[model samples]
Target: MTKPANTQLTDARRGDARADRTTFLWTAAFIFAGMTVTILSAATELQRANSAFPVGKVVLYEITGFLSFLAMFPLIAWLVTRSTPGQHSWRQVIPVHLAASLGVVILHVSLFVLLRKALVPVFFGEPYFFTDNLARDFIYEYRKSVLAYGIVLFAITFGRELEQKRRELAAAREDAKKSHRLTLKCGGRSIFVDASDVIWAKSASNYVEVKTPGAEHLARATLASIERQLGDAGANAVRVHRSWIVNADYISRIEPTGEGDLKIEMKDGATVPGSRRYRGNLNLS
Candidate 1:
């Protein structure tokens, strides 16, 4: 049975919400793991160099830096989504991402500096100063920030593409399962119609008239809904008029009406009018 259009839309929204939640959780886990590794590595380097800085201070510094990037992560993701990677040329995408990367670097530096100034004094009883020279600090941070931005953009683009492919595969499997038959409730009786056996269908008031080689069935459904069912069933059906949908396999010949319309002749010896507006839908060749 075909679901109502509104119901299908609701289901799609629910699926999207669930996918979003899954992506968020996975991203958070990876970020946390990376932060832990980075902090430990930085602490080890300080120990190897015999630096005067405490391990706790090094960890705090790394945490603040990671937190700054974490704060800016959503904006990077939003920019990537807005860019619609594969849809636009590199010429268009490159400039937007470059400008966004600059913005991210500036924001990240400012955020982490502020965090360290606020938290360091409380923990160690001493003030924190990022640098005396702002220009040098920005240039130093810019390189790392750009690299981080690129990594994140690539990850998001790859994830979205993978999700799209997964959805397409699932849809193909579902269509395969329902491709052979259509269930219709007519006159308080349930009727099963083979998709291949359908010749044509027409909208009658609020209902649709489904025609098969063996029988005609009137079902309480809209022509648009019937068209969707036919498509999902993999039937070679095309809507040639506002009120008519004909199976291309049953169409023997198409005659020009000379009024910018067509007379469609079916193999079953039935005729249906085809609107000129829908002529592009037919494979005339």
Candidate 2:
């Protein structure tokens, strides 16, 4: 018995989110540490200018400095997904990438804030946007350095996340190859169904209807477990609605009607749904 690809992805996401929390936490910690270092360095620089600026003041500056970057996390993640990861893993990649990228952005911003302060000690550059300090001068100068730093961080973050996605994709392919094969008897005839042959599967109480190129076969199983077993066979075996799995391969056309309901026509002329809730995964712009 095999599950649909989308279901497996959903399960994978849930499992990965749960299990990979440690990885996420570690990544966050690493970024946070980077930010702390930057803030400390900035404080040291600021201290050179105004020795009266307390250590506690530096901490406060670092905390507030990271605010803009932390707020932009969601936007950055969405941009990355639409720009890169979406193509390889479908929309499933969005949530995982978002979760990971959010952590990264927070880290990036924290570091930026820390470093923003430390510029003076590290590079002897000016710190403020609109004031000539006792040390260095000019608001315009601050703009140039901030922009340069932001560009560099953005590039690095994009590249790092893209690399992570590439690795994840390879792992998914390998997992799919290992788990997506099946042999069954349909109408007294033996048929071998490759993962790709399946357009989707439907559940009928105890038995699941495995729809393939030739015909649909009734297998006694649960769709939930079958979905997991399918692994990365293909995410197109999407859960169009709760009861049906639509194979992405067979999705010939989609038509939008009123009230957020969609009419989808498959290659087999079998019509399914385009419910607003799950449609985002089906055809994402």
Model 2 CA RMSD to the hidden true structure, in angstroms? 17.1
Best by TM-score: 1
Angstrom error of the Cα, residue 45, model 1: value is 2.9
Candidate 1: worst-modelled 10 consecutive residues by lDDT: 168-177
Identify the leading candidate in terms of lDDT. 1
Model 1 agreement with the true structure over 1-285: per-residue lDDT tens digits = 777999977765555445545565666677779889987898889889999888888788888888788788678777876785786888889999999899999999999999999999999999998999999989999998799788777766766665654554455436545666666658867577877888999999987899999899998767876777677788898999999999999999999999779999998898999999999899998
Score residue 136 of candidate 1 by CA lDDT. 90
Count of backbone collisions within predicted model 1? 0
lDDT of every predicted structure (CA atoms): 0.81, 0.58
Q: What TM-score does each of the candidates earn?
A: 0.56, 0.35
| CA error at residue 193 for candidate 2, angstroms | 1.6
